[model samples]
Target: METDNKESIIDYQYKALKDGKSIRLLYLHTSSSYHQLPIEVSLCEFPIDACPSFGALSYAWSIDDDPAPSDRELLCDGASIKITKNCEAALKRLRRPKQDQILWVDAVCINQADLEERSLQVRLMRQIYTQASWVALWVGDASTAVDEESGLPLSDLGMDFIHDFAVEIAERTNSGQALNEGPLYQEFIKDRRAFQYSESEVFAPRVRGVWDVFHRNWWKRLWVIQEVALATDPTLLCGLKAETFHNLKIVIKALIRSEQPVDVMEFNSLFIAHTFHQFHVRHMIETGTMGKISPPGIKALDILNATRNTQASDPRDKIYGILGFFGPPATDTENIFPDPDYTKPAAELYADVSRAIILNTKNLDVLSSCYGFFKSTVPDLPSWVASWNDTPVQYFDGKIFNAAGSSTVVYEDCGDKLLMRIKGRHVDSVKLAGQIPDSIGYSNEACIELWRYWWKFASTLDSYPTGETVTDVFKDTLCWGSHLDYSRQQLGENKESFNAWLEILTGTDDTDIAAKRIFNDGEPFKYAHRATSVTWGRNMSITNKGYLAMVPIITKADDKIVIFQGSKLPFIVRTEDGTSKLGGPCYVRGMMDGEFATEEDAGAMDELEWFTLK
Candidate 1:
């Protein structure tokens, strides 16, 4: 009987969801030890809006490219199935020892093999999670290694430090010892008497714990942004220990406010998590509105851009996962695409999303976000489509430029879904392109050498087309015509800062001396980093019309610069096969602000030239 049962090969089959609003919940049986007990669960269906009290699991499906083996078998009802090591770990940790634990685990609840069912289930995720009693954010296992110096678990030390840091902040704020709450003005908290740890003291283990906590795989997942944001209450689970999401958020906010020692956007998972918590969730909860007044409301394009650097198992989830934040597409007019259709290819879905955003926003500002034109992984993706896969080197301010004036996108679809046609005015063609530095923000000498090379190249031009001195145009072009401060004002009156930074970079004999000086004087390095960062993945190019401009790294001499009807900035387009392929967006000195298209000509749609993008 045992041999017959073993050879039976029982397979778990999912019954179709009763309706569009229906979802599955798993009842995980109790276990004393994960190693000793077989993981068993039973699935039941219910309407999401009226489902029984259950905790939702929000976790990373796979931690890395070569994830641990999925050799563990899960018993569901009378059948056995395979589950990812990460998912299995989460379930094992989540299972209660006393009684059955009900959960809405996506991997177990949803029938992933069925594409139609997957799409429907994805659409209902917002409801599923929002209605759940609590959200368990499983951030993998806690480190068991004890810090020899501190005599504490490495991961626990990190959480304790964060809690203590928050306590210090509250005590200081209440006592009126407020510090400047900005990344630039990070004055150290000298009052370490409470924590009894000094900046110079032997507290390396504590710092390591802080880094480990923030750099978890769970924080970087794309779906967690919505999962945690929409959850009524969220509990961050790491192996046996747990903490509230609110506390974790306080830690992140405190770091941003007065404690970040490094680039939070680079080292810490700042933008996606912070933006979702402080901006998206806060606005909705405070105002009872879907959008915000100061930073604008939740828009599809904005959401996509915010989470572009986040990871997803399916390329399509890059868009689908974010849809739950706003209203449903069938009802909300602002929603870009229809329901999440897994049947569509990723390239096709991305292209369609691009078109929908352009049409919905009535502007080609989305085109400026298209970094995928050159390096997209999606095969046969349209040049006009933004892949939303990776973050752009620098984000162009949507309100800064209006090369095409106050005009809306004039889209002309020629019955072919893949082909996109738009109208634009020919601005200029590239004449001479200067090489961008191979290494930026690393070596002071390399940046100085490259800047000097650029200055020498600028000297070759007889005169500036914008009527400004070549010196001024060249300086402004390096930072893309805007001041690099928090205000982001135009670079017209900030020449002294640029000159002062350059003097420090060039006036020194040793690069080490320059580096030390810049480090000592923070303002100078701020200017230098901003200048180099914007021009890192780009080059300075002299236009055929004798304009100093910034173009893509792939740009060459004779590449056409064109301003689309609704584009805030001009784009570099390379003509091939009688069609245009976008080289990427550019900054043409003197042509950024409605200089190419006058108000009168821009309004006259018939006067513009139309080009098709393949």
Candidate 2:
């Protein structure tokens, strides 16, 4: 009788595999023991075209470095297999007390030890998560104790505050009321009053609590991007508490619209929140939630850019993990996106993916993400292929933020090897590079030192005529060829526009007082700090032809600033021997927004040369 029962269970499980409609679902049986539990794994076979209702588990693998062996026994077909402690915990928490619970967990469902099986299942990951009833995002056990950094408790109370804040803001947003006049603001004001007894004492802890949750390692996982984005309904599970992705998104949107002043900690939390919201928006567009009229699909390059910092166990998954979101409708004959292959090496895979995106998109924007010697930490890869494993350079999102105008160019794939040929203007070379000034300090002396460097550099620029004094040249350098003034020009004449520009650059309309304090007396120029503090990508460099230009902060003295035809901003290139290295995107003051592609500039392109990036 015992042998018959075992064989019967095996036959039932094997039937699903035979039909090629098999998926292993963990059936957690209720246990009276609080800590020890048994999980029954049953192979369920649905029709090949149809899937049954099951919640997919999206979670980080472990909390520590040591890979703990599967300690708990999971019964499958009357046989037992070991399961990890984390998995056991998840199953126990997710399981119902009286009824059996079925879940599709990657660790157990897929044969991870087999490479071919891993690759095949990864290809099916999109379908697995999408077809599931819902996705449970396990963010680990919740902590009510205060976080050391944010000084806020990681408990249900904090989640409640965030949810309430989101609810109030959503109501107002739906009603189309301005964010300032909305109930969100009113609630904020009330909180501020209640906490006024200790300005730093009260809000700091709460802000920190939000910060702690936002910075959770779960957000950094590459696979979670698709798991959450593709889910029909996703729930964030932190310990015993739960929150919907929809509510979190609402709170994120409200926080983005808020103009309230916050300390660095609050700002960091808000930045992460904004990034998450942006990811969701992009995910929606890619998944066709934005409708058919939206762009046919998202490029692999864009997906990579958005999720560059997302962590993965295998470095190759950095590219493979997000590949499912690319390409056309499932029914389309030709799939432009490269299929995930775990066998490929990280560098080679990244290079091939880069080539594929450029070939399919027919745009050189991918090249803009390639970093130069100074910018790139990866030395082995060729200069042309972007370091997919590296964190994306700050402020260069591959957008044409500062291009004078647009142009088209041809891309030559140069066979299967990682080499490409492009034709564009070489422009000018870098002669002198200065260290990016230190953070604008609170003391007056720091401002004076910064102003002195600016004065020396501005004096070299052709934009500042010879007759003008150092002071005059400094002002001209700030105002001349500024895109910020273009909108102000519609309101008034040149003099009015100049004053507006002066006010912006100096942070005050009283330019004379600001200038005198800096140039004449060498005192602390209150507005001088704005130059360094206001924006990123403002490292000062002198061109070989004696032009002072603002290049990417990673700019070196020998780096070449080249303006590729289709690119919006000038690029910093580092040349070693005969080959060239792209140092990523850059912002050169006057060359932004197609200014470089103006009629006169276009005509000057007759001297275009062949530039080979290795």
Candidate 3:
């Protein structure tokens, strides 16, 4: 087909994927123009068994507007069609100057206006990217030349550090040295004085710059996870520079090892750094690059939990986006994968996914993610499933060590609905719930003051007459094996250990004179700093029966703390108007093991009920 008095272009038509059919991809013709390039879009069918070679585009859409027409236009089948500036730029950068590039640019390839076609195309997203010869990650336009002072563009100086760091890591990897053995580590050991005294002067600014790049919106997108993870070969595009995913992994690994000087940076930067660290670690595990240490296979719930912070335009994509990583569906009995349908509401989608995971895995561990319902705007969701569409509940697992231990939860069918069946005893009901206190300021003096306050509080609490010492009970309440164990190692087994735990909580231990003069710097202040920051947001509550527990910040008085059978930690639940709401998970004293289920505690058990969480 041709337009009147215009150059003839390949006319692409939309064809749905039939039972034994292939997907049609947009073949973008090459363009040489640097400005206002008119892309030529043609349709090419890629068979399931013999897919044509193509490069897929992975990108975050522009925030200024929807997929509206811009001044630039693309020639689609001899007809002019307006394209977004973002798409225009992506096409210009992706298109080769001399050769035709067969690409699967989702915006152009799928008839997005047609809801049915969009749903069909989304289901095949995994195939589109995985089958492609390469995947180009468009991180906006190319960056300008590296700046002389910081050796990177001022706006993205962190990229330069990351790139340099990645190069060093690649060198070490190629030389057969472990990734942990590198110049960064050597410098860290050899130049302790420089890092200790000149941290702000030398490393603070550089670290901040690198962190800025990671906080970019592209890193937090939900869909890119599947896009990049499923690709055969992925290339990262930043401005004009190009880097492979392998090199990017190296940079991430290097950053994970290079301890950031948290004392000098802002709290948000520290949090972001920690988040990126976890993100990279999870990515490594998921992509099977973490070697034998990786899990046998990741559960869909785990993926959703790990990437819950990742943003998605449609909430349902939060689950749908990561489906590719779980591998294809198995038999009819194992078909837990939720079909991609844009028509479903976010709550319905979340509920269905939760149900499938529970029925297929036959475990209630998925419900372990449930937390108190503060206030949800999403309509028609049971209190059981988390608001997967909303902002993720910030559960500070880093502070509580034993939180990672395995737990067994069985699922049961209760007449018309599903229910989690577990064994355990009720601990206490919340009597007083306190809001998270104001942050202990970031300064050294402020941290020390906070430490002193906590120390005094601990001493006073220890003086109280109780069966178990206040310190022991409090440590157990925090689920000690993780963060508390580290504190115990730092502080001796005596009274000093109690003070050491306080110091760890306040981020003030390293500031001591004795520790400052020696090479043995106390744990990186960031750990304590994060612990303190996270503590500020947690709800401190006293049980009606005089028990103390730290629940999620959203928890309120009347929430019941129950140690469910097989759960590693206790959970908080709130019952109102004949409906029970799960208040997420928590750690309680004497509940880590099955101690609560023992016959000795039989009399302490509150009544057990078949609680149905809708």
Candidate 4:
């Protein structure tokens, strides 16, 4: 890449974590290598297990035993990394010296070389950096550090919006006292049945009701649900029409001088994230945030119309307005990558396999190695994500939108590796975690056709095998925010019959046959252990999991509300223990039970069998 311009060298060793454990990382001051095309850094012949206490004091490597030799470590694929001029100044800076440096990027590491290996590393990534002597977080929260005014990464941050908004709202307005008790009150209490609430009542002030009329968890709902509305008119955001705006002005002012504020940022990030997530969520809803118009997201052109009716003070803009504050969209995780279109039929069935593998920075070194294989073999990925001129570790799956306003990613464990079936366009998928599919071993053609189904499906929002339409998917999962990236995973209905149908549709054999046998004729999808079941006209089963999208979300009797229905997946009946078992998320009202998408797609399910990482 670029030649070293700084006169000083950053030779360091033996870094220790807060827990006082020795950690190994090639922490060289490659500040001078910014934007340089290609450069090399000498790594010891093998990975170092332990780092030294202090680096650059003197010659560290034993010259007699070194195999890489000086200046012969590993060559970086792109960019020269710049370090801070002073230790304090550099404390927050993140730089990638080279792609192939003994240690390069946490995002691109393909650590799951084996199933056991993957299991061991995922749980450790959270610890490795959290305990690092000093984790050089990039400009974003993923690896280096969270940044300000940066584009939001779709993978992890979006979830923060839904979960945080839910938690925040749940903390407020969850009481049986009902929000309509009076005009919007400044303080509120938790409802015993709230998502995260416990027997002990949790209360807090600074909360407001969704409306003076309903008094729902307006503020507590995913920020995305109301962000667009708020953005249109922040004033409306505070009343019965909208929800409470935890402007956080009071708390922020209080934190002006406290160290706890920085730590507190993590807890409030959901608010920041809802700014964007809310937009994606509402964009798909038919209700249109009260009076706002909804845009049919068929093409990129829809964005223009969406903007026209966009609430003036929309939270989406507010979230993006402070983009740089969260650092980069992704940190240690592979925050950027190719996205499959989730709007189609094939993707509805085949599932997003390649995406599931690269979820987190389980093992930086290992994941990076897997990325190398992708660049070498796949050869053609999206231009922005190409290997040569890119940041290491920049891809993730988990963005899919159903018409009724729902989104989520599906993950499947394919033996040694985790397959994240995603909704994308160009590159269907790229496997990671040191584990490659045996199916991939056969021929790239199988992989190509497999992805072709996904590609065509996501490219268009029709024919999703769900026996439900985009509108149906959106209704149940409206709170789930699906961004433009089309990243998605684990699609077929979670029930066993649909799993079998997915196998037939994808041209992939059913690896889970024992599960297939559970479903009998006269059942939905004619397969097993399903808790719900339904059939269309003429004795035909609607549980085909063939990716044929459900149709006619508009009810014949009315247009304002969709006609509700049920599926044959399994029994929602309660056990003797008084608990109900079901797969996927559902809405239970008195005796009215229906399977639908959640506002946010965090893979909500009533039981382990209902959802599978595999």
Residue 436's lDDT in candidate 2: 55
- Find the 10 residues in a row with the least total lDDT in model 1: 182-191
lDDT by residue (180-287, candidate 3, tens digit) is 466653432343345445532244444545444554556667778778777766887756556677766766555444344433223223324523533453476566
Q: Encode model 2's per-residue lDDT on 273-389: one tens digit a residue.
A: 524733564456656654332222234555677777777777788777875564333753224445667777666776777666665554567766576544444445777687767
RMSD of each: 4.8, 7.5, 6.6, 24.0
lDDT of 1 by residue, 509-556 (tens): 476676566544366766676676676677788988899888887788
Per-candidate TM equals 0.88, 0.74, 0.75, 0.22
- Candidate 3: which stretches are off by over 4 Å? 1-20, 63-73, 80-83, 143-164, 172-213, 258-298, 332-335, 376-380, 394-424, 435-466, 475-481, 484-527, 533-536, 598-607
Model 3 lDDT on a 0 to 1 scale? 0.57
Error of 1 at 427 (Å): 1.4
Tell me the deviation in Å of residue 540 in model 2: 1.7
* Strongest candidate by lDDT: 1
Q: lDDT of candidate 4 vs native? A: 0.25
> In model 2, how large is the Cα lDDT of residue 363?
53
| Global lDDT scores for all candidate models | 0.72, 0.58, 0.57, 0.25
Which regions in candidate 4 have their CA more than 4 angstroms from the true location?
1-24, 30-40, 44-104, 107-127, 140-271, 274-590, 593-614
Off by over 4 Å in 2: 1-22, 38-40, 43-48, 63-86, 144-153, 170-208, 258-279, 286-298, 327-335, 374-379, 396-405, 436-455, 460-538, 552-554, 593-606
The prediction achieving the highest TM-score against the true structure is: 1
